[model samples]
Target: MSAAAPSAQPKLRVKNATKAYNTRSGELVAIDRCSLDVKAGEIVSIVGPSGCGKTTLLWSMSGLHKLSSGEVLLDGKPVNGPNPEIGMVFQDANLLPWRNLDANINFPFEIKGTKPDRAWIDDLLGRVGLSGFGGRFPRELSGGMQQRAALVRALSFKPSVLLMDEPFGALDAFTREEMNQLVEEIWMAAPTTIVLITHSIEEAIFLSDRIVVMSPRPGRVAAVHDVPFARPRSLEIMSTREVFDLTNVIKREIVGEQKSRYVRSSDAPVAQSAV
Candidate 1:
């Protein structure tokens, strides 16, 4: 294991968590007996194949979904429902069409009927490079800019944890890269524990302090890798042999787990056809 965080207790813990749904066929287990810890001020990326419960885990972390077994705890408190300290940014911008960027970013406070510190929001806008665009509508922005706004909106509450579900998955390659850099910048400016669910290996490597690799469906912790690079990392680090080797190691683990899954399915007995 990598060196423990300076603090004694984890900021977030997912312990033996399992999530399942009762379907027509049977119980569908999305995640099984998964356990992990994220330290305060850390950025952790959860990467896995589709149907591997990456999003399920994100929901659990955010207190939006309850686990079938075990639990997710934030600051030693159980996450049984949507907690105020947690903020989520989904795959889509999910912006209200009629609301201007400033209004949309302030929507969270509006719902709570709470007044927010406009100065903080302004600082965030500047940090995310959206300083002057707050008056613009969502439609006026490009895909990347819209997503950047989405991120700022999530942070406007100053939540302790930010749960991102493939926020850049829909963007073009260049836009995605730009957003990745933007995320790093934002995190550095104002630290928060972040849990990002993504399929991009390079993105994970670039943004995370640690990368948690999940197994195939009924996902479990396949491996946990502590990113060796120093923070305020740049895209140049992606070209190094160390990054390449680490990427290959994760790929092999996923591939190997998939092969095992195929073998198990093939070994199951087939039902005989009726006469």
Candidate 2:
């Protein structure tokens, strides 16, 4: 028998990753010596308290933010600039109100000086359950529908990795849940390594293969949990004991970080300046 082809390598590897910010007050580190490896076709979610630098980490990985130290490798290559192999989805959808759904989804193609692939756009929209709404503008579509279009547009290029930052945070609870299910279904249809940053433990558990819990300001990796759940997951699974166990574990990590942060703040010496 012929030898089977080797499987592709992991999509991203972040090692000794450190990111810092400079301010008039002083320099502050956002991410300190954090590291994680993302395998091909796996969904990873980074969750942490406010100001924990989850967004910073994602932007650094995406090449939008330059790291102060360490490395972010995508497909064995350093991520120093925009790479077409990656696509990003943000919280606001950022779709132009003037553009119709099809036009908006095809915007990426247009920017590349390529003609809008109508059939392709239609196919993607159909997959997101917005089959007949292509002609509607962003104003006409509900929050969830707008998000679906945003995701379809991000995938229009068939990127190997998708980076999302709280893409459903602006939606209502019901809409967010529906959008989450839609994303999971989309992942089933077309597998891609995804890195998502979310504030909700439920959303993280619902969508992630691994939950990377982050520490408070000057964040570090506090814990990395391999979700003990099977694929094709649904909201129904959230009610299970196993699901609660995982969720509770993640929540405790965040809470622990918060408590530690408060204690540190309480013990800090008063600020002083010399003339």
Error of 2 at 168 (Å): 0.9
Please write out the lDDT profile of model 1 over residues 1-275, one tens digit for every residue. Answer: 23465666898999999999887666788999999999988899999877789999999999889899999999999999988899899998888879999899989998878888899989888887899997899999988889989998899989999999999999999999999998888888888999999989999999999999999888999999989898788889999999999999988988888788777776763311100
* Cα lDDT of model 2 by residue, 53-165, tens digit: 89989988888988888989998899997778889998799898999987888788878887766776678887888898878999998888888889999988888999999
lDDT of each: 0.89, 0.85
**Model 1 weakest 10-residue run by lDDT:** 266-275
> Which 10 successive residues of model 2 have the least lDDT summed?
266-275
Q: Estimate each model's TM-score.
A: 0.94, 0.92
How far does residue 21 in candidate 1 sit from its true spot (Å)? 0.6
Leading candidate by TM-score: 1
Residue 228, candidate 2: Cα error in Å is 2.4
